[model samples]
Target: MNDFDIKMIKKLILKGQWLLSEHALDKLLERNLRIVDVLTSILNGEILEDYPDDPRGHSCLILGKKDNKYIHTVCGFQNKSLVIITSYIPELPKWIDERTRGGKYHE
Candidate 1:
């Protein structure tokens, strides 16, 4: 939840020290998104939520913008590298808009 994790993630990403899990890769392909998009988003985005106590590991939801479009990325750190847990374009019902959540998704 703190800035350190996000900073570490950004650092790892900037240095090409990140990995995309199988699930994350699948999500990216399904959305027709490129690694560039994910990296760009992470680099330009801000952390909206943090999951420091996730059973899986510490992670966060980052909302980023590019060319007037929005993308959301879930990231975590492991094995001294940043892991892309998942990424997608936030959509209706769940998102009222790019900056607002329409529901309590974590709960």
Candidate 2:
């Protein structure tokens, strides 16, 4: 992913949108966004193509690193895809938790 993609990803994150397909998401980001972090954790290694099955369903995980900050990108299922961003895994971003309650999309 390039700088442009990063910006798009960040935009989507703020807007509470999750890309259903990783490839599609990448294409969208590549065209309009920029990388905010030079060495992001999300781009560190191979992105998990598949997610595990759960109550909330499976989701691919991507990590973004900015300075010492880490953003967790949880890309959920196709039918009901989700993105939960957090500086830390144990504690989710306050907004994310509030929005994700009851498994409903944030408004």
Candidate 1, residue 65: how far the Cα is off, in Å: 1.4
Which candidate number would show the highest lDDT if scored against the true structure?
1
lDDT comparing candidate 1 with the true structure: 0.83
Listing every candidate in turn, what is its Cα RMSD in Å to the true structure after a full C-alpha superposition? 2.3, 12.2
Q: Report the C-alpha lDDT of model 1 over 1-107, residue by residue, as the tens digit.
A: 33445677777888999889999999989999888888898888888888888899778899887677799998887777788899989888788888777876624
Per-residue alpha-carbon lDDT of candidate 2 for residues 7-88, written as tens digits (9 for 90 to 100): 4444554565544345534633654323334114444422423456545554454555545554445554343223432223
Worst 10 residues of 1 by lDDT: 1-10
Global fold similarity of model 2 (TM-score): 0.31
Q: What is the TM-score of each candidate against the true structure?
A: 0.87, 0.31
Q: In model 2, how large is the Cα lDDT of residue 99?
A: 22
